[model samples]
Target: MALPEVSDPQVLAFAAELAKNDGLVESEVLATLEEASVQQSILDAIARPAESKAWKDYRPIFISDRRIDDGVVFYGQHRELIDRIAGEFGVPAEIIVAIIGVETNYGRNIGRYRVLDALYTLAFHYPPRSPYFRGELRQLFLLGNDRLAYPIDQLKGSYAGAMGLGQFMPTSIATWARDYDGDGRIDLWNSYPDIVASIANYFVEHGWERDAPVTVRAVRDATARPVERTTLEPLLSVQQLEAWGYAPTAPVDAERAATLLTLEGPETEDWIIFRNFYVISRYNRSPLYSMAVWQLSQAIARGAAGDRP
Candidate 1:
């Protein structure tokens, strides 16, 4: 039989198929199908081509007015949670707070996408990573049916299906999310403890070095050899950086690898990253992002340590 061209039956069938694939047949899946009335415009919008530009779009979103102010308040409200989680995770509180600040404005702006809708939209319609989204959909289904949350009513997030305080993708939440609040549920959506611990956990899992520096402020000469951005991995030795006229303010006694980072600041700014700095990149994969976290971490630490930030 030919599949229906209309949205209703087609979406219902897709949801049923997805549920069957995940062993959630009968009642659970049929209920999902009952709600599967697709809006062609939303689907069309999803199918529309995405901009090839990355640095331009993603950067501006981070620097937006709402994000920065929300980040500040998030840091203030979660002061104790940040300190405790940081100590436990061996990452500094500022980095932890900065991550929450960056990802979801400390839970104030987690997202609005329904897990079912967003995952289904991306899993089957969005071709850029349909397979990945399909897997995430599976995870979301399992997460939902298992009462792993407060039902679908409270589970909303980003268009790509990331959810909760950290804006974690379903797979990331399934694997790395924790019930730090001791409430038995890993509630990243509303629990400050869970969010705080989850961010720190993500950093540690990605190899943050305890008590080691995340980045080193640096200076480079105008005559320095131009760096290939693709080769931004932290591999050049500090001595090599020195030869290129880069210096780290954090003080390393030689024999350490670093990456040269040029950032667009209110004024031009540069930083040389140590191994730990590279670890921060694993969280967001941007030098500017990592630097922001590091700087914010410094601010939080100073404030907590009784110094004015």
Candidate 2:
């Protein structure tokens, strides 16, 4: 089928900028832009991300018996690299693996849409985040530099244009990704060392504190104030929340900054999330995504209730 042409002025302006700033052949940029098609399913999926789901619904989706099992196996197989990456970056290996597990199921599902299509479709057609996706589309072109192992047109990723095992947005790949294996290329898709180190690097760059808590169960009381769950930052300190009758399930520093979060789904759950939790959210900007990574990492580290660690 003939793909519909994209003639949106803003989108065409994007292509012109790509050619002018990035040194792409003008005709080539226009051709590729024209070749890209609008994917309605991608648009729909982008509207309802798993991160918006209830904790109960979102938890099982990323943290499953099989996923944890796979995480353990992944840890074993990449033990040395995982350890080195963690030690070098001061981020936990389990947390590193958990991000990969949650993002792409340990590379089992690294997305299916052509990244070019995903970005272009969203950049021009999706009105709400057009400017953002247009920026991503520009980064997508930038990612085609030496970072990508394949041609940009051939690269596949999530509907949101996140690529590789880590599900890096194009800007992320451009700025934070690395050639950990020293292979002269940053291939987030198939390089384990590159993927591991790149993900750890992202956390370190985003201020992940080592040997600190990600979250603690909040002891809710009648005095507990209503928390804006959508807010990702920890504005309250451990002592402050306790004063409000929301104590941690475990002891915490009185001065440690945390934010109260409540979960609704299979059961009522609340917690005081720390900065590390906030760092994880920077990758996806969703409280549920960070919580899932935190919980799944704990489960992976300890193993299932009946399974061995």
Predictions: Cα RMSD each: 4.5, 3.1
Specify the poorest-scoring 10-residue window by lDDT in model 1: 49-58
Error of 1 at 244 (Å): 2.6
Please give the distance, in angstroms, between residue 174's alpha carbon in candidate 2 and its true position after superposition. Answer: 0.8
Tell me which residue pairs clash in candidate 2: none
Please give each candidate's TM-score.
Answer: 0.79, 0.92
- Could you tell me the TM-score of candidate 2? 0.92
Model 1, 161-188: lDDT tens per residue? 7777777877777777878878778787
lDDT (tens digit, per residue) of candidate 2 on 205-242: 99999899999998799867776555778887889888
Count clashing residue pairs per candidate.
1, 0
> What residue runs in model 1 are displaced by over 4 Å at the alpha carbon?
1-22, 30-76, 265-268, 303-309
Q: Local error of candidate 1 at 126, Å?
A: 1.3
